[model samples]
Target: HEALADIEDELAGLEAQAMAEQQRMALKQALSELPERTQEIFRLNRIEGMTHAEVARHLEISDSSVQKHLSKALAYV
Candidate 1:
């Protein structure tokens, strides 16, 4: 029983690492396909973990425009 628990823990860790790598690749591929402004907004909101309002303020756009660009960028990704 102890051995089985240890194996399960190891499998869980491997699965988490694989998922992280896949997400990293996906974001990288997405960024490559995005335009400069779209990439900046996505990086700020998704990678940098900023709020939409914060990204809008920094980029000098409205929050709705931020949302629009993010939506388009995600669709491309």
Candidate 2:
């Protein structure tokens, strides 16, 4: 019974990892379909979890520009 429990835990972990990989792949594919600048903004905001203001600061753009890029990226995705 103890061995069975260990195997179950391992299987669960593997399943979670696989799901995360799938999500990453989907995001990558979506980003690849976008324009270069739009993709960069999307990656910074969505994948890296940066706020719009932070992305704007890093990209040296206005916050409104970040929001625009994000909106366009989402529409494309």
Candidate 1 lDDT over 11-74, as tens digits, reads 9999999999999898898788888999999989998999999999998999999999899988
lDDT of 1 at 42: 90
* Cα error, candidate 2, residue 14 (Å): 0.5
lDDT of 2 by residue, 1-77 (tens): 99999999999999999999998889789889888999899989998999999999998999999999999999877
Clashing residue pairs for model 2:
none
The segments of candidate 1 whose C-alpha lies over 4 angstroms from its true place after superposition are none
**Residue 4 of model 1, lDDT score:** 100
Could you estimate the TM-score for every candidate?
A: 0.75, 0.76
TM-score of 1: 0.75
Clashes per candidate, residues 3 or more apart or on different chains: 0, 0
